[model samples]
Target: MAILRGNPGEIIKIWHGGIAIHGGLIGGFIAGVIVCKVKNLNPFQIGDIVAPSIILAQGIGRWGNFMNHEAHGGPVSRAFLEQLHLPNFIIENMYINGQYYHPTFLYESIWDVAGFIILVNIRKHLKLGETFFLYLTWYSIGRFFIEGLRTDSLMLTSNIRVAQLVSILLILISISLIVYRRIKYNPPLYSKVGALPWPTKKVK
Candidate 1:
């Protein structure tokens, strides 16, 4: 933070505020919802199309946290990492301040990348919003456990991680929405005529 650094002259310091993924997600979600409402579009449908991309982005983004040496987990031993059979580069990075830490960022990145692959392939077989909901469910499930390992996570209390809490809520909400939409609307398939399910259905 610029304020925290006492206004360091370096340009990087001017913008070196700490990471806030949830803030970005919330802001983007709100903005996307507003835009969808204005355009009379179904947000979930749009989300279905974009969900894989979002996860892929998130997967790549965690590497940034790695570069910053933040968002890592508790300390471990080099032998511990060797037991896990991690690559030399990863094993080396885990060593910080004479201690090896869990490569939580790598764990999450791998989870998200895998999710992206699964979601992209499965979208065609899924209902309109299920792709997005599935994305949320998958990501949140991984994030819930991964956040548990993170040492720098935001905390509601000494024992409660903010990301883990949010992840749990997201998983529940996403699954709920998927089940509700499936039963209530019987929505069109993502692989069908179009993502604009309501409009396209009436048009043709």
Candidate 2:
């Protein structure tokens, strides 16, 4: 981005130029669409199968932020964090630079882990094309609030957190798509599509 903007003054000097998860998601979706189109496949159905793993990856990826000591919240008391009953190692790690901070990265990682578990368990029940949207809804719900706790969030303005804004939009869009699909098709949300045990037949 710094090179594209032709200005290095405002760019944060991070390896790989400060990558954002949302940007990667958008890029992946576009590539998935193109590939699925060429392959004559239903993009949403493929996305459904891939969604749980995506969150699982997110759960594991957050530790990178932990190691880097970024994406943490404001100063907090040891007593306050201790009340949460977190493990000693985590508590000790949170005590960085002589101050304890909320482990926002850990919070997000746990949220993503829970999401992955729930998605995997409920996946067979969701109709084709619905699981992916459910993933978006579930993830955004957590990301919306989690992003609030982060001091390093990307911002569009002084008061506007970019990830929170994207989360809100994704939540709305995913919910709308789910509702529309339910009303229009009335498909069995809890039943498998057919004998194939997968909905690769068509976009229906």
Candidate 3:
């Protein structure tokens, strides 16, 4: 409705199309909190377990943007894309309307995949509940720059990209929380309790 600059009746149009990942993340967090409360689960532990999987899902989800031909950056040369050494199929899809655009979707997906790898590798070494902060920090770092390259970003102001702004804020907050937790608890990366990736511990 806001993007369309439309009235109340036209607000329904949003149902037909648009969705924002930021909004989804916020909603998911709220839902997670509720579920964690009900289940008597430690939210931080759950967050650590879900961190890598979140990025993995994001990596897979970016393909949807590709299929829809949305979330792409502005025009670029085929030569530029080729120089990046992207796959042949991606090169072909980029060749739309006699021009190639920056494959922002692919860039984000690859970044997410890399983040997943980093998170999984370091997860066991992280303190009791730091993986979630790491996830936020890693994701926001890439998104801050990538959102700048995107032409289709939602705007909070004339010069401000909404996602970029959120990413920046998240990066600061995530890093701050990680520092605070580490100082307070000084936990080792290796966990004696909790399953790999799931954070479930065996009963004594």
- Which stretch of 10 consecutive residues in model 3 shows the poorest summed lDDT? 195-204
Clashing pairs in 3: 125-189, 126-189, 195-200
What are the candidates' C-alpha RMSDs?
5.0, 3.4, 3.9
Better of 2 and 3 by lDDT: 2
Residue 49 displacement in candidate 1 (angstroms): 0.9
> Compared to the true structure, candidate 2 yields what TM-score?
0.86
Name the top lDDT candidate: 2
- State each model's CA lDDT, in order: 0.82, 0.84, 0.82
The segments of candidate 1 whose C-alpha lies over 4 angstroms from its true place after superposition are 1-16, 195-204
In candidate 3, stretches whose alpha carbon ends up further than 4 angstroms from where it belongs are 1-14, 185-190, 195-204
Tens digits of lDDT, candidate 3, 72-176: 899999899999999999988977778889999999999999999999998887876688888888899999998888878888789999899899999999988
Model 1 lDDT tens row, 1-204 = 335357556424425665466666777889998987777777777788789999999999999877877789998888988998888988898788888899999999999999999998889999887898888889989999988887877777778887888888888898898888778878878888373334522210
lDDT string, candidate 2, 177-198, tens digits:
8889888976555435533344
**Predicted structure 1: lDDT:** 0.82
Candidate 2 lDDT at 109 equals 94
